[model samples]
Target: MPIASEPGPGAAPAGADPVPQFSEWRKGVAGVLAKVRRVEIAELPDEPEHLLDETTYDGLTVAPLYTRRDELPEHPLPGAFPFVRGGDATRDVHRGWYVSAHFAGPDAAEVNREILAALGNGVSAVWLGAGERGVPVADLPAALSGLLFDLAPLALDAGAATAEAAERVYAALDGYDTASRKDIQVCLGAAPLTSRFADAANIGLAETVTLAAGAVARAETVCAITVDGTAFHNAGASDAQELGASIAAGLAYLRALTERLDIAAALGQLTFRFAATDDQFATVAKFRAARRLWARVAHVCGAPDFGGAPQHAVTSAAMMTQRDPWVNLLRTTLAAFGAGVGGADAVTVLPFDSALPAGELGVSKSFADRMARNTQLLLLEESHLGFVQDPAAGSWYVEELTDALAAKAWEFMQEIEAEGGYSAALDSGLLAERVAATRAARDTDVAHRKTSVTGVNEFPNLAEPPLSEQARRADRIARYGATFEALRNRSDTYLAEHGARPKALLVPLGSVAEHNVRVTFIANLLASGGIESVNPGPLTVDTIAAAATEAGAPIAVLCGSDKRYGAEAGAAVEQLRAAGVETVLLAGAAKAVAELEDAQRPDGFLAAKIDAVAALSGLLEKVGA
Candidate 1:
């Protein structure tokens, strides 16, 4: 299962020209960049490479611009070796990817109803969550009682009970009247390694291979093992880490399966699942990279003729927010679009309210479920996104990102292999450590607003009514906005106890035009933490104390231009303090309040790029929320 290191086919030969035909274009772009710097960035000291707008993600640098000079020298066509473009040479324009719906159940009847509703509407596949967190092993038969086994493929996630669940599915299929069971696809979802890591469930690898042999004996088109990356993704692994881990797991399964079966047969028994996020370009590149990485693995195993890696893309659960749940619709739509365009064989969009408590073991035909199903349907039928194969094939950015992501993932896989494979890496805590590091970095970005979660960290609506509570499946994901949501939760509790939300007074030190920007900034920041902002507009220094006293706010923030702040902020803070405002803050920078006398200076400052979580948490604490 160890792949040899070698340069990819697209690598440039020795002494080849790196930037053919771009001299004139480069000069023109340079001139435009210089003009931009001169006109807009005159205040900042210029640097040699100041004009470039590069960003990095998962250790890959994304250049501001790409040209033919940046393109790889060669790219294999669709359905060719190392199928980066796509696994299929052609796809049905009417139906590009399988519309897969996910269901979890402890109740068979409820699961059956959801499955039927999904299939009837538009879903082409069913991903059933079976076992302890999902359907009971004994209830599999009743859960899938009326499902058409041939028309709708079944993928099971049974954790420790995978073997039993597969047997039940086979038993149910035994009663089918179809002449060829091979027409139906079944993914038995056996991942001993991932299941062990995520749920501490020990499923035997040898037993899983034995089940695959049984499936092959029955001439069933069955994928006995699923290398699911969502477990790692939800645990906060970056895209490359998730891909590398998944590939490593797939290789491990292949080695075990190959002991009893040939290379091609073992290949047939495996499938992949990846998480698709709202970062559309990254999601597309990640899936495309997955295909390329596995194709290389297949080639190394002497099975170049294997069709492609079977991929099932699920919208990222880690990106879903509990505070501003409605915005999840847009996130899932973008993610689903990316998955489809990236050539996922099947795509699953989790319900918009998936993070909320639903009072059930599985999602049913609620409005959220219907919306999730219809989102994919609309992409296929209305948007006609399925009308093309490898829609991102020729874009320079996508191609470059695909190559970069694939290489990074391959490097990660090699690291795991060097550490004695995935199991040893897990045992030694190497895998968890790396994932934790990435999660920490991501959490820092969210806290500082470097990464914005709309409706949670960005434009939160404090007045929005809460969704009704229901029992929901237990999850352990570290959601990006969970910290901000915690503050909102405390605000909710305060509201319930005190009969009103905590309030902060906004003391504008000048006219509306002079203070509008800082005023808006302070107001939005307060709302994100569920605190109300009481703005007594354009208060004079003489009237500010009375306004603060009348509002009965425990805290007051001074908002105005830097000039206005220097002119009147010290006096405003003094008056606010006299009026019993427990704390005074300036919305401008700390330097604006630095010249004031110690007694007149505000307690703190609020400005851009601050650690929003820490600031909001402190505000809540100051107000006794």
Candidate 2:
């Protein structure tokens, strides 16, 4: 939502300035919070100030409120030098972004049918998935049959076989009219460094550059070298890291190609692809920052007049979850919106179930592809997101984020350059090391619920049907929630083989009011790891021990208020141990159970602060769940 610059009704006089009014508003908020804490105004929440502060992943602080003071100094207009706002000064408001739909089926005929249907619906571009899994080079003629290449831009990702793939595409275009052939636009996804990073063979950077120079000479619209950051992004690189890697890779390509072609021609032969996630502000800022950074690169290379880097945004595969695949629609929608608002020339939203490794039937696959196309259509047509030039242009938050991201990314790019550029950094394992550190930090956050994935680690649907083994593809990219999903899957396997998940007896050691909160917390926590909690109502130590013995559960967990835990936990542990409970877990912190002697403490603790993945894995192994 756009921030309101005008003062609200009735508070300030007509024609009064907004700056002082905004300052007065801040004071009013403080005054109201003071009144609420003092109980003068019982309707307001106490400590409302806490609601206004937030921290971003990069450690950037976001204020609840922003004023004109937060705005950056004036920059060049859209399509101007630097092109921070956008590539075109007019910003293609009338055309909107291209809705690129990917066709990855192996059968060329099926891919052709899918592409035609996609274009007839809402897709503006055809993205042929390149590789053995996609349309083979020999099948390009069949895939391109009956397509009007001039009308829709064609983009393909062939991985290491990019040169051969590009040739196949060009050969297939022989069917198009000579006049229309010159107008066709194709983004040749040929990034050698990206292939090398993924450990794929047949990466030919020089050959790809050679092909790009030829394609540019033949057709002005064909981009020969696509600097893709999807591999780095899927590997869990931070936003700055992804940008840095992409820019450095692009520069490397520019340096190599310029030896044979002019700087401007070399620059025009490049296209950049970045992953767009559900973090709307960050995605938007990353794309915008990319343009600014590229402009600087071009300027340094004596090609300042070259246009801004054209960007293609693909909705993040890393963010897609296989468990509750429907949630991916929302994720893609937000990503598409961010990409459009951030001035991406095109955006591709992957199907909701794309994260699954199994093959989908034609009917189901078509449905998913249609949904992906419609997401971009809805954003551009109904939402009209692309009608405005740099919709985030004047917002203080976006501007600040853009600048900060650019600075961080620029630093990373410089570091890579200092180490002899992108190829050198990747070869030396510096890029991988950086991405690994970020991934570790991110995984820890997801494990502890600091970052929540709706249907995976948090609020999981325990009743959901099991995914069939045939439908489970082993080749799917790893996601942040993979570890948690593994735990759940193991429990599912155990249940199928043995008829039940291991049960945990929850001993709530106080009255319902005293123990209900912790009981619920512990139950949900255990459920996250597929451990069923058996609650026979709140009970005393003797009753709890009798119930545990009757239930025959190998594990027992105590749940109660800190005061109750301190008073009764030691006795409860002794009773549970006497009843032959193999392991005892406390719902709260160990220090919370003050009355428990060092020898009387439970086997382990399950609290909000602990590493949830480790705790749950340990519990599952102990109970054979």
Candidate 3:
């Protein structure tokens, strides 16, 4: 699986000119970088804008960039002393990544319908959004039978509060024949240990992973329990806390799974799920570090032979805003790019309107998915990002950052171990206490302007648009939860509605404007055809700034070619009060749009595709804001 070596029996192996051709020190296995030949960085030293930092999380220093690689001890390659890249082999998946779509609705039939839709459309895996108490797929067989994609779509996640509930869910999935249906695929998640767990509903989460591994294929089901970093982030977990606590959670799962299934199965079945938002580089670096640490953990557990662990990434919920739901597509696109580049085996880009009410929104829902998928298409077919593996493998900053992440996570893991292992640490409230402390710090930083959320803290939601969505899932949940008598007894009252303002502007950035031009025309067409319409003048620093400042409506249809975007645009939107806009979109396909977004910057990056439009409209209709 190692990407067939050079033409000849290793014809001088292409790429980064053999180190011996330039340096002598790097010739040995795991040789410490004696010299790296420092060169000028267009982004570092002289750059006015700052990307790295020395901030702290719960008093722990959060590495801004990576640490000096030469300063750290070295580990062997995959299957060697460290196994960082992966285990022996078999991990080098042909190309692209496993696909996925999440289902969270209360209705069994409706959620099943979504599963079928995704499968037919090309999703290889799924994450069932069971409530705190799981709804077993076994409880609903009709839903699973509609698959149009591959057979036995992986049954990885079935969330429930207790072991009993999780078992029921798995029992339902295990009903399928893996040989014939391959439905045995699965990973049941345990709810996160929240700040109020001791008194609240703390159930057997590790029990679920252990139980699933014991019953299911030892090779499949990810043995790791998700930290639900996004769940914590949504509840206000700080960056470092999200990172630290997740690392701790991962370690806990490794130890626990190893206990139940042994180190071999624990390492083989273990995988990590992360949330990627608009923080492009951070998202990338986070995964890189995660892979590094996971390998180390396997080694530390005496399972040094375990290869690459699966890393599945989903977009962040905390970052998705219900107000400007259309922008979510753009946000997720960059997140997807970060995950894919960071080496995730699977990536799920949520519909932008996810934060919104639900189905009540406009059809903009499809737009989000289309853009997400098409963005990958662009990266693979046009950008050739997938042609090579670990494109960022040798970046000085990336490598150093990866090392730093590994070190930090390892440090935190040690701290957790000191607290009597992850589970004991959780039981003692260490994880929650640490996260709480970090959350407070992050809030302070945001409030004090040490950190900025473009459209949130700084750019307040100034102009409130009319009702754009209704409680979509809430309604569905009600439908499912409501019995005949309950429905009959429930109050039925309706109120009059108001109208949302209509206006659209196309702002395209970059020197090569072909893609954006098409997107602009599409945006204009969508607007004229019924949606609001406006075209910002050709993308220029002055024009973008002027339009951003003077724009009246909550939605600004911003467009820019990949080449045109960077800190300039980021700077322009850096101060654009988060309050003013509902949607800050990049008017083009995902390929171009993903490059346009920087969570630290101003605009939503996405193409004006019909699905993207539908997805945005879905949010608007759902929230009715």
TM-score of each: 0.91, 0.90, 0.59
For residues 471-572, write the lDDT of model 1, one tens digit per residue: 122358978888888888778878877999999999987889999998998998888888999998999899998898899999899999999888898888
Tens-digit per-residue lDDT, 1-625, candidate 2: 1223544354446655535767567657867776656754345555455556787655566677777656566567778768778887754576688888888878889888888888889888888876674888888878988888888889887776777888788787764676756668888877787778867654587788788778877753788877888888888888899898889988898889988999998999888899999999899999999998999999889888795878999999999886777888999999998888888888999999887744442337667777888888888888888788788987888998898888888999999999999989988999999888988888999889788887877777667666667544454354877777777887787788888887899998889999898888888777778778899998997697799898899999999888888778898998999999999989888788755687679998888877888888888898776
Clashes of each: 6, 1, 61
lDDT of each: 0.85, 0.81, 0.52
Off by over 4 Å in 1: 1-54, 200-202, 359-364, 466-475
* lDDT over C-alpha atoms for residue 39 of model 3: 30
Which whole-number lDDT from 0 to 100 does residue 315 have in model 1? Answer: 98
RMSD of each: 4.2, 4.6, 14.1
Clashing pairs in 1: 105-134, 105-135, 358-470, 358-471, 359-470, 359-471
Weakest lDDT window of 10 consecutive positions for candidate 1: 466-475
Whole-model lDDT, model 3: 0.52
Residue 293 miss distance in model 1 (angstroms)? 0.6
* Candidate 1 vs candidate 2, TM-score winner: 1
